[model samples]
Target: MGLRVQVDNLMEHHSQKSLFAVVLGEMQDGGLPHIGCRCPRCVSGRVGYAACLAIVDVRGAETAVYLLDATPDIKYQLNPLAEWLGPHPQRPNRFNPPTAVFLTHAHMGHIGGLPQLGPEAMAVDGLPVYASAELVALLQETRLWSPMVQGLALRLFSPNQPIPLAPDLTLTPIPVPHRDELGTGTFAFLINGPGKSLLYLPDIDSWQAWDAAHSVLQTVDVALVDGSFYSLAELNGRPPVAHPLISDTLAFFAGWPGELVFTHFNHTNPALEPNSGAVATIQQVGAKLAHPGMRFLLD
Candidate 1:
């Protein structure tokens, strides 16, 4: 088995314009699938996806990569991550591109990388993709997504079920409310691998949407939650296409029994400018903003 578990917890930062490339994910080859632009709001636009994350294998014999959300800039995003892994040719089967990908919704930013995944591209064999039943069916029935669903096996998972991806890593999908064109069943993954566990729900509409009947907050070691917008009135770009704000989310986590970090930022949100009042407020509540290279060590 391989040895370190890491979450490429990256995000693109911008003020009224672009900021430093703390962990910038660049799109090097091929044009993005949907709309294109060069402005800060366009390039770093929340919907277009300024940053994408790739979860690399730390210890498994299969050096697989699990893509949490495939941002529009994926072609550029995969290059750096692949380079970082380099080629361990001498080591048996150490350089496969990625074993599979897991998507949250049908948003262009989330699944825009699907084309690259087909036979014409990576030519991956049955790259098992995980998503809700509705999301899978929609991808299958739709013209744009039909090829991807057929070219690669799109594994439709039931809400609140667990699927094992590695000897140590299993993904638990927590259903969240969202506006999926097919139907809403946005999943919050409970990724448990060997000794570490992480909870991801980066696109929920609000905390009030959860099932208060159960104590879902204490179920994991760490949470990377929806911080798409800072407030309802921030009224920035594209209205999330449908997602929640940070204010309500932060309050929900105030009583959380585990560590909660935020991700999926919008350009208009003040939190984009680090150390701004918005950033301070989030930190004051004992929560952290998701840092791209952040790693969690489990015993």
Candidate 2:
């Protein structure tokens, strides 16, 4: 059945698990069911949360959990991992915050959930947040984000430098071209687990624009790249969108051996529907659409 269900089944069957990454969301920044749009997909209630991922390692006595991109739907996204997080040691009837959070960029969908970690919600103390130097400065120096920053330990990392999460687990941020506002750059995380590696690239302009697209993607065991729009028709009369179409992406990566799973879909994307022809085309090529709750074991 769906990858999400498969993940849940796998989690239940495993008494002890290894390093893995879970698909917390698969939709674009705004997520599905756009604010005022009455599109078929939005009305169908088949929409999903914005792009987010959770990396979990249960090999240790206490499960270690980290999140990639703090999306707007952080609350619901974090709920499924409550068992792994355990309970807050100081607070009763509350879950402990994730070990850390790594942001891909300063985009709203990527960092909007930081407020939830402030006084109003989790009120986490000393929670580690890894981001680019510019992003770290923007958040720490901005008055609006001061409250949240006070509770977080911001770590500024340069692109291409690997941040070791564990002895064997490392994450390297690779600069990628995207719609960058506020002068903060964008990144696609390359997660190197003990045995396997996956690239979590939710947003990008065009694959051709990237110099190392082929070299980086081909080296990973799994590549979850952007599939924001399936075709130009989805834009209607609007100017051409920034993201690469699914057709173009498929053709661009033709014959690449790594497994491809498309994520960060727009609301109007027909591939969001399981029975759509777009899905058939993608599946025919051995690639699949990302679904919430989907998990990929590193080993």
Best by TM-score: 2
**Which parts of model 2 are misplaced by more than 4 Å?**
1-10
Worst 10 residues of 1 by lDDT: 12-21
- Each model's C-alpha lDDT? 0.60, 0.88
Candidate 1, 39-121: lDDT as tens digits: 45446433323434455554434345677756566555565455334465564543345556778777765777788766675
lDDT of 2 at 85: 89
Query: What TM-score does candidate 2 reach?
Result: 0.96
Cα deviation at 104, candidate 2, in Å, is 0.4
Tens digit of lDDT per residue, candidate 2, span 38-81?
Answer: 98877876657899988999988788899999999888788767
Best by lDDT: 2
